[model samples]
Target: MNWYQTWNNPLKNLLWWLVIIGMLGSLPLAYMRHETETSTKNVEFVFDYRDLLDIADLQTNPQKFVQDQLGKMKAAGIGSMAVYESTLAEFKESRRIDLYNSRDAAALTQTFGDPSENFTYLLFTNNEAQQKLEPLIQKTFADLGVGVKPWSFKNRSGLVIQMSPDDAAIKAMDPDPIAMQMLKDQGFQLVVRLSNHREFKSNDMDRLLKQLHDLGVKRIIVDGNEVPGYTEENTEENLNKMADLLNKYGMGLAAIELLKEPQKGFSTLAKQTNYNVVRLHSFTEKDGDKLTEPLKKSELEGRIQGVADRFVLAVKDRNIRMVFINGHAVKSLDRAKVVDPLSAYYESLTGTDGAIPRIEKFGFDLGPAQPFEVHTTSWQKVARVFLLIGGLSLVVLMLSFFIPEGTLIFFVLGLIGLVGVHVLSANLYAQGLALMTAISAPSVAVMLAIRTVRSGASAKWKSGIGFGLWLLLRTSLISLIGIVYEVALLNHITYSLVLQQFRGVGLLHLLPIAIAGLYLLFFSENNTYSEKLANIRRILSSYISVLWIVIAGVGLAAVYYYLSRTGNEGQASTVEKLFRSYLENTMGVRPRTKEFLVAHPIFVLGGYLAVRYRHAVYLLFIGVVGQLSLVDTFAHLHTPLHISLLRIFYGLVIGAILGLILCAAWEIVARSWKRWAKPQLLK
Candidate 1:
């Protein structure tokens, strides 16, 4: 089953031409993506104002601390402040008003507690506070059907509500107007935060948004699990209403990255707003603790470096333009003082080797982040069809390796199936085709490498090295074609922002390796098709041994471990993390560890060894890891195209270097065994 001979059939030849044409056609889509990504050059760092206030409250002078921190943050390159929906507790902390629970109010006024009911009390701290917050408080409790009445204390205005202080504290309200004005006065941009915790009242929310619009707020980051105004049954209508308000006010949404799941109604809201969205990365309190909790200077520095690296990756690799940095206060036992992470946060952004400079070096400016301005062309439809054809043909070509006669049949069925999927859901069609290309491309590349190795055996070490390097380059190119096809087919902006994603990632990681192994087992030998089938039967029927069974168990464990470490959330050893940091710092883009360290070296060694030992063909199964990873790299649509290309390039160069070293070592070991060890054994 010579691969070249298989392509001698007209059908296979036609399929190859289709794939080539598809690759050529998809160039425009990739170009479009390049333009879109390059168009967005502004990155914004936003400090969480609520978190700041929470932290500030822990300081001796809350107001002075906030003012001082804001000045420092502005100096440290923070340009915006994110304000969350307000609560009574927050207002009390900010000193906009004085709030008192039933017991406290009773103690302060020298009155007995109410016999059966508890009521919350609020007192305006100043005339300005009274003028601004009086109507808001009255209307807020009035709408909830909770009793509200006027009160006076020391000639200052206040309100009494017929709810327990605890019950009153949790009620969501508008973001504090005073804080918005103060932040605006400080020359900070406002990123209003919203949540779906309150009852959905379209008119009320409209007024709130209109007020935020007047305050010069430009973006909103939704809190909790749902977008503001989202409702279960009337989700569409609610999102449409929210989208209309956002559009009317000229404000966009920031889609937070790495959420447990996407916020509900976000995709719909984004679509309705004509995709007015930017990717946002949030540095949570947990992340802050990693940097500030460590008392040792070296440990703290390393943690800060890790966070800084994430910021750089977010801005440059992922299309994250907005970063939300949280703050927290920690009680330090050794220092006997309350400490805040504000200084460490500043260091993360503006230290000597901080995220700000690194991101700016990568061509981003400090400004308000803008949504990607995606420009669509009429020709993209035709280009997508070509990409679809290319993917289907690639799939058919892979199938032809095992079922050579079914090339035309598989193509026809694939075409029909894709059409059906497209008619039902375009996203499904794109994701399905992308997965097919992902699997088929690597399988085909590995199979072709095997064919090339089998065609000639280079006994000389130098020839083996050259042959292996050549095969590596050729196979990588073949895998890259799959990337082109995937990029073209799933070129929707949704994927770029991760509002939608390329599905079947786990399958993409595993299938090609399995396919390559099966192909090697069945077809690597020069035997008739029936003989190959008989050999498989004989092997399956062979008697088992305990030692072999133990080896298989270990092999399965290795496979399980390999799969566990494939995705973004994969666990890595501390040593590996340090090594990765070194690589990233040295290279500016860290090539994946598995690619350079494991897959690529194995591939290079496999190519060299296949010529010397027939059994070495099994190494191609491992080699398929690198090939598939190259293709899978592009499946992460959120990663910028150029970054993925750079990563792949680095992986190849470094992997090839390491592979050559392994080949040289093998040669040394073999020579030693033949000259000394083998002769002694023969005696």
Candidate 2:
């Protein structure tokens, strides 16, 4: 039959109409679900040149490469870069590091040979040693090269010098003015980073300021320079000197790790200074530049969140501007491994108006009187959800009473109950548990309902198996639907926020399946044991001896399982990534796959099959199978909530399409079976 004929058939036509209605209706939901990429552009990015390449890569055209990478960094939302006095290559070239006492050369050697290894700085820890060795190194470098000038003092907790290399060695040893100018032209803020080494006390400070001023740097980050708990009596001279330096250079200061002791003094400084404070928190202490793996699900995001919380408090209390820098994938492929999770966590912690991101965009708006709050739950939103649930419940009840749609009423009631359960829960995981109850409760009800009606009926054991698989398919679909609505419209579910929803759900979800099985065996209908052969014998006799068909089904199921496991199975994979990337590139956001492909199809197919094959107990079995799929899908709470909702939408679309095909094929099989089996099976 063609389109007209198919439409004339009630089952096929209703299935199509359901698909059309679901897809069309979902368009609005998808639109509402669409999200904008939250910008972290306010973040100041740090680049220790040694993190990118070693002395070897800097042999030729290194500045060109470094400049290109900096361009990429700016494009990727880094607002500022910090300049230290020395890098490994510059140290190695100075020819003075060799004259000093031997230290661990591992950091320098690792970067030299491996182009991929460079995510950390070679932190020379001996400030005392460096202070003593500085003059010798400076004198040695001045004599070693022609026209070599040491631009000195205070960086990385040691005394070091930035050398102006001779014309011939410029590309190999020093920063090019042209490339530095390009960075400035690109609007990249340059900050001179210094430490509290003793050599920076007097004449060295003046030289440092003049050098920075000439380099177009207007910001400075000084560590340990300000006296802790600085009071008028002890720090009067230091404060005067700092003010003079700030005024003369027209530069701002960057403070870090200054909140712990004498907080009130820092608070006083925060009001008067334009310094930006960064909190010290390392995600990884690994050597070299490769990013460590992302935070695992087991380690509740308290480490990061704790730091952010404390940082926010200090910043607000002090009225200071703050910036967040990462310890993982700061600049490389798979940057989102850390960046996105942090962004999502901060959003939850601080909401859309997060102080950190706000500081990045607008800078230090916290007045002396203003207090910062991470986020507050909108009671208005909660009320809206409550009102919607009540209104929708009433509508469903009205439709159920007027139309006498038992299954629709039951399912709609189940959905409304899910929302109530989710809203009443403490968090996303609890909400998911409530949703599972919703998926299973109706499923158990349907199974019990089927048992009551089909208690006196009978069927071939082979048909019973098909019916079981069919019920599995149905429950999975319903479970998927609940998850989608719960995730997208209700909760901001993500891996960082919620634990896996599979706990306790699997057993409860499976209990319904077991109950369905019992109903099939005892209450409903099934082939009885023969005089010599039992339920097994009848099914063997009834099922056609198509070895090829059995093999084909196994192969198809295996292929589907493998593909599903690898592709869009539950977790985001390469396929999901590529598709999401395309969507994000084109549409700025992506939806999940299981929505259209897995769960939605199961719902349409399972419901229609349950309706058509009510007497055979087929749909319930398939719906049960579907419930398993749905459970497995939710087992992956590692996915973002929006993506999960998208998956359900995709599943519904695919399920409806395939449901049409399955219905058409089963129609022929049903007719043939009527002739071969007892007419009572049809009833």
lDDT per residue for candidate 2 within 1-683, as digits (tens), equals 36633433343224323423433333333233232111111234344433333322433564565566566555544455555444334544332233121122233333233333222212333454355444434443454452323221235333223332232222222232333445577776665555433322444466557766876776555434343225446455555565566557766544443234433233333333432222222222232122233556433343443334444433322223334243222332554422223233333234443435534333333211111121224443543343234323322322232222243444456566656765676454344443444344334444543553364332322353344335445444444444433333333312222212234444444454565555555434433334324554665677666896898799678546534543223356666655654553343223334444454444444444554355435544544444444444444443333444454444544555765666567767878787867576777
RMSD of each: 2.6, 18.1
Score candidate 2 by TM-score against the native.
Answer: 0.39
The total number of steric clashes, by the backbone 3 Å criterion, in model 2 comes to 51
C-alpha lDDT values of all predictions: 0.86, 0.41
What RMSD does model 2 have? 18.1
For residue 362, what is the lDDT in candidate 2?
30
- Candidate 1 C-alpha lDDT tens digits along 1-683: 56744644788889889999999988998888877777789999999998888998987899998999999999999999999888889889898888887788888888898867688998988988888777887788888899999877778888888999999988888888888999999999999889999888889989998899888888888989988888778888888888898899998999998888878889899999889899998888887876656468888887777888989988888899999998688887868888778888888888969999999888899999999989677788788788878889999989988877667678888899998999999878888888889889989999887766555543444667787788789899999889998888877889888988677888988899888888777876567889988989999999999998999999999888888788887888899888988998889889988899998898888878876775666676688989999998898998888889999999999999999999999999999999999999999
Against the true structure, whose lDDT is highest?
Answer: 1
Off by over 4 Å in 2: 1-50, 55-59, 72-186, 189-612, 625-643, 668-683
Q: What's the lDDT for residue 439 in model 2?
A: 44
